[model samples]
Target chain A: MIATDPTPADRSLLATLDRVLRGNFTRREALATGRIDLPVGRLIGLCLLLGAIYGICLGSYSAFNGTGHAWLQTLASALKVPLLFVLTLLVSFPSLYVFAALQRLPLDFRNTLKLMLLAVLVDLTVIASLGPVFAFFAASSTSYAFLLLLNVAIFALGGVLGLAVLRRATRDVFTPVPPGKALEPAAPVEPGATPPVLPPALSLPAPSSRTAHQAADQARRLLAAWCVVYGVVGAQMGWLLRPFLGNPGAPFEWFRAREDNFLVAVLRTIGNLFGR
Target chain B: MNFATDENLLRGGADVTPSARACLGVGAAGCALAGLGLGAAAGDVRTALFAAIKVPLLIAFVAGLCLPSFFVVNTVLGLRDDFRAACRGLLAAQATLGIALGAQAPMLVFLGASVLDPYLLTLCDAVQFGAATWAAQRVLARHYAPLLARDARHRHALRGWLVLFAFTGVQVAWVLRPFRGTEGFPVQFLRPEAFEQNAYVVLLDHCLRLLR
Candidate 1:
């Protein structure tokens, strides 16, 4: 009976996950008017667990395509993708915070970290959702290159969608309320951003539809920027954890030299086209 | 309501936030020193010295090149407002690459000393450099993300800037070779000044030849 009841933290984590999977966020008004606190640690843990599961699922392709100790190599592939995404996000967080401030998104460091982590979390979930389809294709496709390109395309599609939701959700949820006026205040107006025509009463951080739209608009571009940053960061992480799709002939390798960098890989692909 | 545009796009030395400056500046500088140390661990002391002095120069020069291109691209793209911030942001981000790499310096040196195999050492270098580059890009994107609300095209152009920066950085590295002095070759700062072998083309050839 005691074991049957989930802890309060578990409940919170489950609630956040439910919200995220719903593919929409709390309305800006609701988020601002009502409290938008989240148990960020638990939520992130859920996100990583999901991401690793998906990564492992996707890593099955490496095992399918590679030879000689392919199973062991597949395990490495599984470990690498999650490691790559997670490590890159952690390493680059400070800069992300600085950038957030620069944009006057001005996410408090803690919230900003949570928002970014959540974004990545969302991305991994979306990718994982496609895992079954990808695994199916990997099983059928004999050409390693074809499968690799297809997986990359799928991952990109997932990333685009995940980021869209994150942008909308984080904007509404994380936009700060004025000091001491969480329940009733005017929309957040950056100092000198708006003309001072409104009455003193309007200065409070109240939930206005117009302000909600404005806030969402403000975060749209920043989210767009994050998409690119995450993409590049993810790519670099992937390169380091190479042999994602093993060449059919080569024995399984967990890591490859820098010879497979974007520049080299791209050029080689192009060159093969011209030479053959 | 207009967004906050501080009249001075470029904050001066005095105006620069100490934390931001320290994070970026020390990071970039440390990466340079560590790069040499890592290179030295791979081969000989002279090679290490060459790497130490030059990798930082490579990072700075590449970042310096990015500034003008960023300004020109933004101006051409009708994003004049973002030019100053973009420039400064990149400078800081470039420093971040150094910081990220510098942080890993100890681990890299340990690997270099312990692993005598050149192939393994090369793999280590690749991993560290790749991770560092990713971290730097994350920083740069952070600085520029909010500007995305103003113009979506800027994101496209910013990405272009990244590709340009990366291609140029890699080429510069190739041109100034012997960062890790080949064990058998005489220790020289430069790779004996030969005609630049197109690294990409060479890679392409290797793969194509392997198949044949």
Candidate 2:
């Protein structure tokens, strides 16, 4: 005789994930169906003002230090060059635009903020690890390590404060119209009057098992794709820089060659490694 | 009779759909592989310890970025899957990347220093600014853009970009300034090397040139 089985916790967890994904997709659909009522110019102006303030703060810090001719100052000056800044901006803009588009979908601010922080944390990890390597290569001794630490610390501090301020300000500025305002208050029913009946089809559907399987599959695919892309890119970079690997200053001078030979050589080396 | 039939059905269902178990098994295997790779690459206990310290940081980063997405996706998909598991997997991936990048830091630093030769610090400064700005932009665009769009607060987006630009700007200025031989206070703060390292002194000397 067969025995009865208990519902597993994993089943419930999968069901919950499915619900979230569905909610976001539904919200996106709703927004697409709704009217666009935002004032673009005002928004742009606000952004510009904020940018100006930040710029002023940076400039003030530089001027007050009296060491504007120092290493930090030189770094800051190099960043001022339009071409370099623009190039960096261009590469990242598309990704930002996609993020903005995602934001248009209804999601909780708390959840969004959490994700942003996580991303920043990931970036910090990369930077921190990269820092020591840089110090080592630059032949920097113990004294210079403090500078690296300070730079990293300042950036991290700035990020935390910025996120806090942005969250508070956004909440105050973007109030949603209450549901009562959105729909005319249901005509006042007489005392004990029968409540308006909802259609049977409008009732929540029973959660399906099929949806859970599908979502898991999608997530797996996305993760795999991400891994592949990053892996390929990393490998390519490593290969291109291989010949210069053992050379004392090859990594530094690799970018200066006008001919494609250097890149070709690196690529061939990578190809051979992979081929093996 | 009804109870007996229901029990049979449940048993059959469980036996037939083992994908969750399979997925978990695969995930575990992938993690093991990653762990092994890290161990081999590190070679010794001390190196492993240093790398291990970065693991929590790596987890924090991945969780910080992907958790929301995981929640949102799960919510939208109506799946009740384990959010923690997803987070763990992503964090592991991030840690691997962090380790890989860390391994190469020495080379990058050396390259950066080489670029500092012949007073070519200006070019080195430019590269750092360019790379950092590029990275910052990518983060803002990929990670922060959605929140800005959702809230209709474009200011956050602008602020994000400006912060990155500001960072790059500062680095560039510090690299290119004409300092003959004295260590300017800012130079002291901004030196990218260890205090005892001659590179710091050399960099400080550059800052002093302007003072003279």
Could you give the C-alpha RMSD of every candidate to the true structure, in order shown?
Answer: 20.4, 22.0
Q: Per-residue lDDT for B160-212 in model 2, tens only?
A: 32543343323333342221112222312133432233333355556767667
Provide the lowest-lDDT 10-residue window in model 1 chain A. A195-204
lDDT of model 1 at position B18: 34
Index of the highest-DockQ prediction: 2
User: Which model scores highest in TM-score?
Assistant: 1
Q: Which residue ranges in model 2 land beyond 4 Å of their true spot?
A: A1-45, A59-61, A68-89, A94-276, B1-212
lDDT of 1 by residue, B1-212 (tens): 00111111122222342344554457556767676667766557677877888888777766665554354345434467677666666665666677677777788878877887888888888898899888767666666766776688688658857875775566567656767767677877776443234444456568978988
Quality class of the docking in candidate 2, CAPRI style: incorrect
